[model samples]
Target: IMHLPFRGRLKLLVASLTAIILLTWLYLLAGNLENGRSLLLSPCLSETPEARVLERVVLESRVREMEEENRQIRLQLNQLQGTVGQPADGGNYGNAAWGASADTGPEDVENTAEERANHTECPRSPTILKCELIHVACVCAGHNASRDVVTLVKSILFHRRNPLHFHFITDAVANQILSSLFQSWMVPSVQVSFYDADELKSEVSWIPNKHYSGIYGLMKLTLTKALPSDLTKVIVLDTDITFATDIAELWAIFRKFTDKQVIGLVENQSDWYLGNLWKNHKPWPALGRGFNTGVILLYLERLRRIGWEQMWRLTAERELMSMLSTSLADQDIFNAFIKQNPVLVHQLPCFWNVQLSDHTRSEQCYTEVSDLKVIHWNSPKKLRVKNKHVEFFRNLYLTFLEYDGNLLRRELFGCPSQATSESVRLQGALEELDEDDQCYDFRRERITVHRVHLYFLQYEYTPAGDDTDVTLVAQLSMDRLQMLEAICKHWEGPISLALYMSDAEAQQFLRYAQASEVLKNRKNVGYHIVYKEGQFYPVNLVRNVALRNANTPYVFLADVDFLPMYGLYDYLRHFLSILQLGCNVTKCYVKKSRVLNTFQKHCMQSSSKLLLTHLYTSLSPCRPRYHVWTKGHAPTNYAKWRTATTPYKVEWEADFEPYVVVKRDCPEYDQRFVGFGWNKVSHIMELDAQEYDLMVLPNAFMIHMPHAPSFDISKFRSSPGYRYCLQTLKEEFHQDLSRKYGAAALKYLTAQRNI
Candidate 1:
């Protein structure tokens, strides 16, 4: 510390302070660099895999944030550089600029201000993107049209997340309802405006009114004048159409149009134009090039240039209109215009506008449902359709309407006031009326039957059933008379022994039955012999014959060798008697039932429906081989039988062809399955397709009698022709099912089973 002058000391102090400040700055910069490095390596030292994953997710989120910021910056830069296109009318239409932009003059700002004032009352989204807004137009002139509009609007809103402006060309009443609906829904990113249909009608007065098409058709022609001049393009849709995908995706079609193309539309699915317009004359070069107007993309700017008045003049020309199909009306006009100037029209994919007029044509045009963006119920309105395909579309329409503040309240809830009052009145009247007068009108009701069958006698052994009597339809041979006699002696129930064989074999069976004391002495038993000449067993044919010939309203199609357990016939008759009163019986099977060894003498002597039921009830809750029958078995309550039942067409039950108790009216067994493969299962599947309910009885069981193997394994293995025939028959059954129900029906059946 040297003593220095005061000025020197002050200068030294200032210099020292400056040096410390610089050092502090350097240290801070180094510390920040070290912190950055540590942060970069922290993920590597994460204590657990979850921490590392979380760190990566955070980094990804940050990266996305930065990318979005960068995009915004670029957009701002482009806007400042004047790359966004200006509106042709020099007004701000609130549409995002995409094309090149130009410098705005004072006049432009003034015009924009004026336009904004005019649309100040119109609702708009505060956070809409700076992109071109989609303009959509629809006509609402009648109650049906109004309802359709509500559904269409809801569908669009459900699928579209982009900003749009909906222009509704409608009457005053519809406009009010639409406005109220939009307000109630609190829809976002959408601005709705109404244009009077009467205005368009007045403008196009020169065009003659056609019964084939209403004034709604003329409203579409006025889009060039009806819409604001600022709108460059618009998507015109029919009220009857519903959107399945984003409206923005359909709006993108406008970009695909060439410079010369003014409209984009899907081709007409039907040949109405070719058949009606081009008939009895040399068809035009574009005869089949007609387009449907259900979904149309109009280039409003181009239409303005072409002059809407000019189009109206063409429509007014009686001779020109006469040349086109009167039935087609406006569609014919559009086709004629496109024919003359094909360059003006752009053909779109058929899926964009799936016209639901002819199902065959629609199926041929759009093969996959995923490809459909919009469904147009054109010919038969959705409300009037009865076909399944049309019904599906109708359901979608109703669902959308329901979503839109229950627009279908009357249809779905049935006018609450009237329904409630009527129901209360009916209840009161019924209480006062006598029960005897409450007769049901069952004349129009038809019973649906579920069919099932049993395959038996593959090993050739007699079954024991001293307490049960059931119709035993057996495919007989000359050697099986002893087996039949034994079965007849054991079973105490009525028997319809159906024998399917050659004429000689049938005669032999009849002679044997006549001679056997067991069969002839039993007054309840009868024999039906059907002569079938073939090496292959026509089991299904004989089963069908037995089913038809059986006198009982309820029939059990079982093999001759099957033995009904002790209480099986008693329980079955009880169940059937109740079923005949009201229930529609489809399929019935026993619980915990199995095929026992034919050589086991003790099993046949001791086994009965009662013993089986007791054994099943005593066992643990483990699943049995045939668990469906015993699943819901309550010995005392018959109504609980349904609990043990499952859908007959389920995957697990695909091969479970047990003895089925079916009503007489069930569809006959398929006779094409001449051999063992699919004879029983095919009939069960057909019944399942008919949507019949099935039942399972746990208390009543039947033991299948073991028989010799009917199919010769060695022969089948060596014979390719036999295997091929089996495969061919299966394929034919599949083809028949497809032709009747549809190719998707089989797929749906499999899917249902998996679920």
Candidate 2:
């Protein structure tokens, strides 16, 4: 039942041929008869035994050929039917999570949706577990839609009290962007899926206009086709709308719906629907003022049963016949359909969808309503819309945009002081992956530590920012606490520190932190402890612990032994905020040499390091010591860095372990590199494999406080077997990366060899 013409006709051909073949066989089995009730069994009896056998064999061969033809035709029919799968239970999803089937063909999208109208047997993922989820759908087709979608979703999460499911009708670019965001969020209440917008638009030869993605907006009408048919009801929204109250209250309105009302909406406050916005202005036909499609409570099941596909398409083609393209936007199509079928539309309160366009007489709704439940920026001008009270709505949106979603976390723990380690549950329980696969065996053998005790203790509790987006993340051993205050003082932002220590060492550190002027009672710094259970230091595990716990939008992954330069935190924030949404950062941090080998340059925020420089034309007191420079830092290009004011790109993704100020959603550290050697290298290599652009920030620098090598490093250096194991592990890692990336892995090999 796809919109495939040839396939439909081919099915008809098969049915007609089958009927004709049966009739021919029936006639051949009987002798010819002229009169009614005459005997007709003479054909088989008149034939000799050998002749009968030969005739039967001939018929069997012909039948076999016809069956083969039928089989080939059936295969072609199947090729036309692509995936339309449903979401599983609202909890824990793997590769086949949400409503998206892992097996859905990317290339098999149709021009116009046929929806397999009579498909009584809906396909669902066998692995999906079912639980209740509040379904929400959005049409996020273009670039800016992702940003708007984030704020829209953020507002929902901030206000909702139930588990959420999102069905995004999006393009390839937006899908990748939102996917990374969703993964990083890890909100237990949220689930997201992507449907191909390009797939639905693939065969369309023309469009209404470039703005509003033309008919892409109208694609919401195809929700039954785009989303899981099993999802009976959903609230569809525009990315530009923000809810000001608990979504549960809005959801409860469904109880007020009559049996015939399939779609719920708020009537338009704009005079455009009345054809009075401009002189000679003509608008789409509607019952009184048209209803806004920005906030919709769609009854998907009722829509499917009502022949929504045929009704909408026929209505759309009829409307478009007289015009070149639609100007009223996608809402025009909905308004047109609802004009004639008023029984199917349910009117919601105007407060649920308060409009803010100049053409809209929005003040009328404001006067009638006591509260603003939802705000819609339906105009193309958005914030610049000509409404009397636009500033209030604009600020409301900006508040949600700047809101730190971390504070909305569902989990809150209150551990009593008397609870002993044995009595308390372990934080971040390790998954016992089956060792049946060689890859799984390799990981288990290499990983010596697993438990991540997040926020084991806190010296102070600090909010994310008055308005900031960066969190500094570092990992260290108990012995390396010398510059904790210096680093904390240097960066006046949130810092998440992961330390490898015993229970006693953690208590000692917290007591010490409490007593210090710079560190004591500092609300901005979070301490996570990974207890050393007599195992070689799991440095990457510690790094992952800190990175995962960072609750800010951006994180600066530096070493605990390093101090950031003055103005670097604010500069990094300013730099990231202006970066066209801080996209595709490959070189997120500047690579600076160790302070032990170079001049010690500190922050102006606390104190500055005075240094005597050798030959430098610039005013910088800090300079790189070429004579004592470490290996693998040649990629940082210190010579270019000395004079360049602009950021530079590092061609290699691996080997160059530069400090990074990356988004909190970055790829996690490869925990397989438990000790020290390739932990950071493997992370950057994976980033490179994902094709992220690495750039070296010009002003950012992490002044490393050089110290004696750790016990793990000493062991790695002194023991030959340990070195051999690390080498074998490195090779194994490369092999796995090769298998995952195929020929792309060869480029990494080339880069590694060059390094």
Query: In order, how many clashes per candidate?
Result: 13, 8
Q: Highest lDDT: which candidate?
A: 2
Question: Any runs in candidate 1 off by more than 4 Å, and if so which?
Answer: 1-131, 276-289, 315-321, 381-392, 404-755
Candidate 1, residues 1-755: lDDT per residue as tens digits? 25988888989999999889856644443334331232433545666786455455555655576679968976775563232122222212211111221333455445445544455434442332334577899877643466457568768877765666899988765665566445433333566789988878876555555534466676777788888999999999988788888888777666645565687777676655555534474322232436788999999898788775586456447435454333444565666666555556666767778777753256545446766789888875455643446666767776675462322222212211223343355446556544453211110011111111111111112333331223444445454556766665555555565565543454355456568776657655544444343355566766775676455555676666555555555566665555445433432432212111111222355454444334434442211223333421222232332233421222224444555666656788887666545676677667656654444544444444655656634445677766666656666676787688775448535633553
Residues 1-755, candidate 2, lDDT per residue (tens digit)?
A: 35659988799889899889856755654333232111433566537795466446555655676679968864663442111111121111111121123322332112001222222344442221122357889988544576577678878888776667799988765675576556545555566788998777742334364344676766777787888878898899989889888676666666545566688887778766778877987887876677888899988899999998788878878888875566766688788988767656667767888888766766655453338889998777888988767778778887886565545545312211222232232222225555464344335534343333455443344555433478889998778877788887778888899887764565577668768988865667877666564356777878887888787877888878767777677887787666635545653453321111122333222222222222223433343323443443456665565555677776664466667766677888877776658887788777777766667665556554667777878877797867776767777788888999898888777766766
Among residues 3 or more apart in sequence or in different chains, the pairs in candidate 2 whose N, CA or C atoms overlap within 3 Å are 89-129, 89-130, 89-131, 462-523, 586-693, 586-694, 587-694, 587-695
TM-score of each: 0.36, 0.46
Positional deviation of residue 40's Cα in model 1 after best superposition, in angstroms: 42
For model 1, the run of ten residues with the poorest summed lDDT: 441-450
Candidate 2 TM-score versus the reference: 0.46
lDDT of each: 0.55, 0.65
